[model samples]
Target: MTTNPQETTPNDWDTRSPDVQADQVAAYDAMRSKCPVAHDDYMGYSLLKNADIKYALEHPEIFSNKVSTRHIAVPNGMDAPEHTAFRAVNDKYFTPDRMQVFEPQIRQVVKSLVSKLPRNEVFDAMDGFAQLYAVRIQNVFMGWPASLEQPLIEWVEKNRRATLAGDREQMGKIALEFDGYIRALLDERRGADAAADITAELIQDVIDLPQDLGGPRTMTDEELISLIRNWTVGELSTVSACAGIILAFLAEHPQEQDRLRTSLAVGKTAEIAAAVEEVMRLQDPLVTNRRVTTQPVEIGGRSIPAGAKVTINWASANRDEDAFEDATTYNPHRSQENNLVYGQGLHVCPGAPLARLELRVLMEELLATTDLIEFGGANPTQNAVYPAAGYSKVLTRIS
Candidate 1:
């Protein structure tokens, strides 16, 4: 139940269960406050304190992202100079200008989905509202055929299974299937050679790596397919989870909902943004991010040797008592500039702005239309392993 700073290691992480991971993070917070930095060969010498986390994030040299736990783009994998290059490929798509262009489309997507809900009927908001909306938008962003939506849902499920199983053959088979699908899309875009969609823009993007690390790095066809697959894996499940969690919290706290409604009356994005942040804090979509040490390093005066794997307890770090007041309680207005939900440093999420926009807009639309959303059936249970936190079903009545 308690994490001893001197006891845990990088190798101790459970890659399969979010509940178990959450427990580990909770335990780590106990030690983080006292030790700040600690050694655990199982955990790699992790710097758990807020100060240490900031340091580790900012100083990518000491703690690298080159060998990522997720086998995709180097965005979350590669550290420093190289990280910047991988990030740039999709950076423009998530920029303010692009977000402005995508806003109407995103709003329309949410609106259409919400309109389809039966009047006064109970439905699972997580499945009906969150996952459906997020998946549709993701498809829009990826330029995938609409027909593939069902396939995508299946793909995400199968991909998660492969990842947890560590089945490379199964993973590769799925990846090839996706690649063929994307390649056709790529070919279509190339054939038209006209106005570019976000996916097309990414395909044509030439990543310019820093000279110090290497020359310009272009995303190969396979890499592009992998990146899109990774994006599908990384973005959809968490966003959907967050969407449901936000609504669930709002449904439970009518006063907060009233406050949010009042703010929306005046068209204040900050109010909704604040509420979303709190949801993010409480929901903690991603339980952990893992890394394998390439070189031995000393942390908290203890040395962690090379080739060790470490888990970044994001959920724990965000809730560290040292970092926030009443870390366990949900406070909508707690607007700190740094929240680990999107991550930190050079490897911060490239799609964060778009994701934020998606969340903010989804909330706004929901609040505007629905007066009340109350759970109708059994309490929703989340997936224990893959996708970390999300409802298997969340039946609710729209008022």
Candidate 2:
């Protein structure tokens, strides 16, 4: 194995530093300008520029997604033929048709949650609304009962805390806790007559494998748990963060909020969706994704050898001035053709269609039901640290 000489260089930046954690996007932007390709022990190589991130994502053969050997992450943690097959199975659940059918339920879930918010009063949108909406909608989508809501919410918090602390042991225990929840659901579904729901369908789904490794086969309990866990991560973490970000953006930009509220009232789904995407692009909900090098490669004028861990800073890439003109400006009309919000290449987020639907429906209901959404109280918005994006506490008022 070739050792990367650059690894000996002192760290360019500390990702876990309180300064970076306080404002990840700003810190990354600074790094992108100074050192687009930075080496660090925590993230191996942090690619901050749009071009560098795009290059890494496009050339997944060199930058493998199998960052960890311990856990299986279904399609996300796989590459090539394996990723392709698993992704095929993963795509079936988030089809446009499935989203269309599921739209009303999502809206119903959002509406129910939105109605309960105390109008004209301050509330932590993250905990008070976004998290609740994310968990409830996920339960509805997965066919889980309402009883699992609180436990899942608590689990998400614990998982986030462990991740922030870089506590592998705690993360493993939390993963097992999550597996236990899904395992029970799977067992219950298997024993009873197959119900008409996503979870039930997943329980019966199978992936055909090449004859060399193994022929066609059903997904093992472990595989099912991993797949479900991936979905939950999307729903519980990214989606929830997106909720807080979107709400906070609207609160900060009342004019844009007014525009969306008007657009939504007239049933302008495309307009609302575009605006949501743009807002998310401005303040991305997802922070970073990991990739490990399979071969020596050069990126951003730096050489990295095989086995180097790479971190793709999505939040920074989406805001790269080289990629988008006036990158920070919120313009729904701006071309998103190169936006890395859902990512690119084989491993792009499969849950994007569902996430878009959820965000749009939630925003539409939020705008339609309330006259305004503005910052509440005198408390300043508190941004979530590394490993999480958006606000940790977004105090907002609706009237």
Candidate 3:
């Protein structure tokens, strides 16, 4: 879309304004009820309504995901036939059997960290807990050594800082720094037939390319690196955000916390996963995803032209009152059919199964280990600004 057309639309709302930056979810909610398809230079055309966002998600042919071509993003940055071939290979890594095999290692990671949260002392869950858990689990899945954990965590931070700064040159360097890490890992697994991790699988995995392209062949290093980038960013950023959100929610809501603990006592562990999803729906972790309209289309009574950029507001859409009754209220048992937490249709987060496993195990361990968790410390937690979602800090104390 960047190659074909540009965003010439006038601003309907200012996404960078103090009002929106202070609280993205609330601002988007207001936008959804008032002007569902607002536009800004930042996101171009923002889709705030559930129906409109779903329309874009389900109709990827019309609402293309290929928003840029300057850099590769594996299947996510590709469209249609090209995306389908790469996505097939991507989907295989997170199957039920794979998650099942990965659960014990995930539990080990969860336990090691959860044990470190000081009992009855104030701490930022995002600091010592959520962020570490995200990076550690990623290392576990990728078969990367623990020695890489601190470096990867630092890389994610630098990447986020670079993104928010709009420092492309620094972002490029940070990206290359990450690529070097993965390339070194790839080099190690190149001929290790005994390789049992997802990285090794990707090394040997073949993408069934269409006849017009090339026949089935192993993914190139560039392709593999891009895929890993997608997976790593999603895991580190959004998963940590989700963990912080869930922990913060439980700390603030004692009744809900006790109810979940009761559910766990009776072995209703699935409730932990349900609670994780429901909480994330309220304060969505993964924020906006971009698409480019392939043709002129009408959305939310607004006329959009071909080649205009579209931003799908997952946070707003999930909390939309029309989509779910009493939408803002937490309900773990509610239906998630329309939930765009992982997104919808094509380009949905491929690592969802692994993500769900990480989060569910994390909550299970925390709730099972702690007698109570509560909001504490006088320091006010800040809302993560636009382009970054979740709390910058979640102050809590465990007991």
Candidate 4:
């Protein structure tokens, strides 16, 4: 379904103003019903409807992922055969059984961070717990040195801050620095002839597949470096942001918090898990994913030219009125089988299992240990307009 450019209004871009943020759910409802495939520079070609997003993710060939560095990873960029190989490499490390091995370690990381809190006093969960814990956990997964964790965290912070500064050129420079760091790690892993971690495994084991893009069948140095940088950014940013948001939600809704506490009391980890999904659905940290048209296609009764960029606002689709009941409200008990937070179809987040593990462990720790996590100071400012959906300063009071 294509939309007429003349009829497509700029009013559709929900750019997260205070008013917009407050009514994002309402805005998405309107967009999905009235303008499912409207064009706007801010949101690209908006795919607000759940069906539309589902369609887009399913047909990766038409809606190609190979955008510029503003988006990274050859897999993230590639459409089909290329995308498959890269994703296969990632799945090698991110398998469900492999992630399950780290459950105890993830719990320890979460507990260790929470344990450091000053008893019954105020602190920023974003910094003291969420960001710090996310960084450490990421290191654990990647088999990176613990010593390098702070520097990597500081680098991502700088990259995010540069984006918030509205400096695209500066953001690129920061990205180069990040890529350089990944390259150095890749080099070390390749040179060292020893038992290696996942990162090392990627470098040593080449994907023996068709290479339409370049020379070798395997991932190039640049591609490997790119994947590492992208994985780190995606993992660190989303987990940190979601952690703070969940804490904020729990802090605001003591009734929900108590429900979680009592439910966990009954040894019902299932209930608590359901609550996490609800929180993820309501939070919906990611705004949208961009896709480029590889061929002419019609959507919403209008024709989009080949090579145009499209944006599927998952944040909006997760709140689609047609798909969700009272979409705005935080309903933890809301059925998890339908939510669009982790996206749908082929492009559904492969890191989802690890993300669930991390979220579960953190929530369990909060429920088992703390009396309450309260917002004491001003709300944390969102870090960026795209990708990294999180707080700038999230001050809090936890007891």
The best candidate in terms of TM-score: 2
- The full ranking of all candidates by TM-score, starting with the best, is 2, 3, 4, 1
Question: All candidates' lDDT scores?
Answer: 0.69, 0.87, 0.87, 0.75
Q: Given candidate 3, what's the lDDT at residue 361?
A: 89
How would you encode candidate 3's per-residue C-alpha lDDT over 280-367 as one tens digit per residue?
8898897898888889999899998898888988999999999999999989899988788988787888988988898898888888
Candidate 4 structure quality by residue, lDDT tens digits, 97-191: 88779898889888988788766666677765777888999988888888888888888788877865578899888888888778777877877
Q: Once superposed on the true structure, which residue ranges of model 4 sit more than 4 Å away at CA?
A: 1-34, 69-72, 192-195, 211-217, 377-387
| lDDT (tens digit, per residue) of candidate 1 on 1-399 | 744433545443333445444444455556666565544444445556555566667766766676544565546666656666777775766779878988898899889987888778766676556766778999887666688777767776677678767798998898777778778877777765644676777767888976775677667876777677667777877777777776677666788777888899998879999888877875577766666555676654556556655556676677777678887687877756557888876777788898889989988988889787666766543433443563445566778
Going through the candidates in the order shown, the clash numbers are: 11, 0, 1, 8
Which of the predicted structures, 1 or 3, would earn the higher TM-score when compared with the native?
Answer: 3
lDDT minimum window of 10 residues, candidate 1: 6-15
TM agreement with the true structure for every prediction? 0.85, 0.97, 0.96, 0.88
Query: Which of 2 and 3 is ahead in TM-score?
Result: 2
RMSD of 1: 4.7
Instruction: Assess the local accuracy of residue 100 in candidate 1 as a C-alpha lDDT between 0 and 100.
Output: 94
lDDT order of candidates, best first? 2, 3, 4, 1
- Evaluate model 2: give its lDDT: 0.87
